[model samples]
Target: MFDIPQLDLKGKVSDAEWQTRVDLAACYRLVAMHGWDDLIYTHISARIPDSEHLLINAFGLAFDEITASNLVKIDFQGNIIDENCPFEINPAGFTIHSAIHEVRHDAMCVLHLHTNETIAVASLEQGLLPLSQYAMFALASMSYHEYEGLAVNPAEKLRLQQDLGMKNFMLLRNHGGLTVGKTIGDAFMHMYDLTRACQIQLQIQGSGQPAVLVDQEIVDGIRAQANIVHTGLTGGQKSWPAMLRKVYRTDPHFAR
Candidate 1:
């Protein structure tokens, strides 16, 4: 078995919530390793599995450095309940994440990022085109939101929620990408596939050559296939545990 290094997150959260924190923390690290994490600005959140509130990264920690015990727990109002750490949580990021968690009853985890490819693709007038197999699934259920500065205004939440309407994937125009899932596994998987799809599209576009696109009818079929509801809700149960094991090998504190 592969072992992961442990990074200490000083706190005393429960076992289940701690597990969520660990997986989310690993997501931050893995995203950084994949070049998807953008400094400390973007955020990833999980809905504490059974709670209405969310578990999100503290604003100051680099994605690669976050650990479970360090994750901040806050209500929908953004009030922090776990206070062992002094890091600030991003209010704007929460506004975006909270809106989704509030409306999307099925969503358990929400991951947001401003990766270069995601932003570049979002900026394009065409958006994420169906040039790859992954794109077919990505574009099928994706929503687009026109940029409105830094997403700081409370009024924008309404439009953001409206734009996201029923779709699990969103492209923040001129901004970046956001994915929601009923579980960390699902959201992460969506992001993993979606990010790679965007990277592939952007790379192909840079070639300045026309690329073949997928058929719309087929694209819809793929969405139906990818829908995890028909599947099971333990989104990251299989692979994420493996990732946790990897992270734990180096240091076991992620479960703290």
Candidate 2:
């Protein structure tokens, strides 16, 4: 993957953009570290700081192989914005991300994944049950979008935006899970929580006993608290530094 010497874009772009690239790259590494990556598929995108464009992993790069300089910059319409970028963005992946970024001004980063547990939950008749605290956390801001095949059709964009509405978490029926955040860390943290929730749900469901659902009142209270907390601070600020440290310790190349 490193056959060509990747450009060092640290000083070429604005500091804000560079930092966004670093965080987004770190996010990809973190996803791979957690074993949630779907090989070279799936995508995580971050809106360029103060711009209409976004940075996404190049179409062929594995999550662990992504680097700050290797990410591609593209407009919402999938046009490559950086003339020197050496990679192509996947059209289907761009469709999913651009659909969200176009309307969700609050969503600075959008993450989507298709893990065994997440897919297991999505394929169920009732998606993402409120069976655990982790589930409750995701349910607080979650919405569901009925699967519409591969999401490549241009018409699906409007439907995706409409289904997403104002929610920060989404379950793409028969597909997988999605999360949005005001920062890359926030988005990653949401996906982590949602994935944990799905894991717990699958375990409980496998035990052959009916699940004990959380109380609706308590769920409502937690949702309210989440809104307050996220409004006060970005979702992962307190933990993101440690997360980046962990990523660097594992492999510092993502920040390159």
Give the clash count for each candidate: 10, 0
All predictions: root-mean-square deviation over Cα?
4.6, 1.7
Model 1: per-residue Cα lDDT at residue 93 = 90
Off by over 4 Å in 1: 1-12, 83-85, 226-238, 249-252
lDDT of each: 0.80, 0.90
lDDT of 1: 0.80
lDDT of 1 by residue, 94-118 (tens): 8899988888888888889998878
| Candidate 2 per-residue C-alpha lDDT over 47-67 given as tens digits, one digit per residue, 9 for 90 to 100 | 987899999989888998899
- Model 1 is weakest, by summed lDDT over 10 consecutive residues, at 1-10
If scored against the real structure, what TM-score would every candidate get?
Answer: 0.87, 0.95
